[model samples]
Target chain A: MTDPKKTVSVKPDADQALKARNGRNIALALGLVAFVALVFVVTLVRLGANVGNRF
Target chain B: MAKPAVLSPDTPADTVRAARWQDYFQLLKPRVMSLVVFTAATGLVAARTHIHPLLGAVAVLCIAVGAGASGALNMWYDADIDAKMRRTRGRPVPAGLVEGSEAATLGVVLSLLSVLLMGMAINWLAAGLLAFTIVFYAVVYTMWLKRWTAQNIVIGGLAGALPPAIGWAAAAGDAPLNAWLMVLIIFLWTPPHFWALSLYISTDYAKAGVPMLPVVKGAKETRKQILLYSLVFIPVCLAPAATGLGGPLYLAVSALGGLVFLTLAWRVFRSDAGDAADPRVADRALYDVAEAPAAEAAPAVEGKRPPPVGGAKDARNLFAFSILYLFALFAALLAEAMIGIRALELPL
Candidate 1:
């Protein structure tokens, strides 16, 4: 049986890997935010053109 | 020398950690959101008026985001109970992949953004309905009804059933009779669909202190309720054809699908009752294992259960068929709408 109280320490290499993974995740989130903003801007421009045409 | 801190598998790390992108995505409940998007799109297409494709796409995106927002909020609030249940323990908040506070903040931000963007792009009516759907799922169902009563799914299904109407409103700027009929069909379908799942996983609800029908009222009564709801769902599904929203193909699909669903539900009811009547059978062993005291029987690890037979098989069959029934019915309606087929009149 394993000891319940033992602290499992991450190796330095493993810790570096985890940090790198997290950094990639942050970058992906930022990219998604940019895409959503682009969609919003395009939608606004199209709607504005439609309104202008109607008038 | 100071002893290192003891940590259980369930415990979060002491250090603050950046959430992985997958962790945030898991909070959105992507599977549920996919179903929401599909049903909403079907409703939009089935509407009488033609909407600009761009606006239609935006409306669908807004509804999807609103649904995801509700799912994230539900995960945040139910993290405690989710951690206790085997099926949900791997969820982001429960698994310590993401903080509950972070999930809650994401949910709130998404909810506001979706509703506001929808109102600006489409009409306020659809936006309002989307907002209400989020609140109903997050607050009414997750916070209130889930723990309070066994009738939770029966009432709380309204939120899930409203997306079609929201889609119709977005396209036509008003909900008509057909939209309401779609809502009614989904509302009636939810109890049986969810109850079938609950019958097999009642122990999870019991462990989590959730008042699912199977746990609160016992398996026999829950099975009977499943049958009763399926009986009601069949007619409601067929009603769309009568209102001219569906055509011959839609009517045929509903009839065949309803028959299959009802048969499976009946089999489940009989199997459950059979197990209850005789506890010595191997089928009863599985049921007993689920409800047995945690001390007596070790917690059955997820995905490790033996191949289900008898009542377990029946419940799983009904659950699977229920999803197909809804999909077939909606797909038929969508096809008829896109093709411009008129409803075929039957000889009285």
Candidate 2:
């Protein structure tokens, strides 16, 4: 198990592996987009709510 | 659904299928995450602080992700034992849907992400508590105590208990007595809830060589301990109302629910819950196990002596009811706080 070569690497050409890889890529993209959006929105809410109290 | 790549002797070493996204999600232990999210959200709301909904949502997400990270790490570490038991055999790493190294990587990555995001978006105190909870569960509980002591769940429960405290900190910028009261409820509740489960299914732990209370101390002692914990747990359930953490609704739920919980514990104590030989669940198919009448004579699986003619329904009742009772307790507090019900103040 310690040997990296022991566990099979993802066979990207196989149909199931190909589907899984595509699905994972899509999920990663969506998650990254969501994270970016969340950070932007949280920034707006925090800064906007506090803008009036800024010294 | 894709088949999980179970390796047969004939199967080549290098021909495993890629893990699906669902497997990755299962690695998060989403059912447990739901409980964490609910309790944490309730704590934030009960604090009655004027945090922006967005910030509150972010806090809950951070707590959920941190909890999921901890669970993934546990699955990674416990894969060997998990595979041996019927209960946890289907988990991603043990079932071969996800590799142990991948689970560890996901756990580490998510742990960092959740902690960083929490610190950036919420108070550093909340972030710090979340990080501590992850470490406590992953390292202290999973790596050290689980195998070492019968008091595993008792101490390890603090990891589960701290989420509400984290949520309270996120909202109020500090956790106070009332917040810790919430933690104490869960901490006290954990032993009875888990021990009741261990009563019926302890053979699984024994097979896996896990040092569960029942496995280590024997079922009779485990039952006695469960009752003892229940004795303490029920009163603590009522403490929130007296401590002003809960209101009329909370009081009603905790009181009425506490009575039923105690009665179940009493039944579990009086009954021969864990004394009989438990059913060999590993030999039975999942559907067979589900379809078999829990209280009736469970058919022997592969000549394995089934648990005494009638299974221990008292233990099962307490186990099932414990989940609902805890949910009701938290829901009452959340509802009371949200609906603006005043707490019952004593004129001492």
Chain A TM-score for model 2, please? Answer: 0.65
Q: What shift in Å separates residue B333 of candidate 1 from its native position after superposition?
A: 1.4
Q: How does residue B217 of candidate 2 score in lDDT? A: 87
lDDT of 1 by residue, B95-209 (tens): 6657788789989999998999899878899999999999999999999999899999999999999989999999999998889899999999999988887777777688789
Scored by lDDT, the top model is 2
Per-residue lDDT of candidate 2, residues B1-348 (tens digit): 334344333335355457778789888889899999999999999898899888999999999999999999998899888877776776777667687888899999999999999999988999999999999999999999998898999999999999999999999999999999999999999999888888777887898888999888888888888889889988888887777788888888999999999999988888888777555443553323333455255555654554442436678778878889999999998998899998775332
- Compute the DockQ of candidate 1: 0.29
lDDT at residue B231 of model 1 (Cα atoms): 86
Off by over 4 Å in 1: A1-55, B1-18, B273-309, B344-348
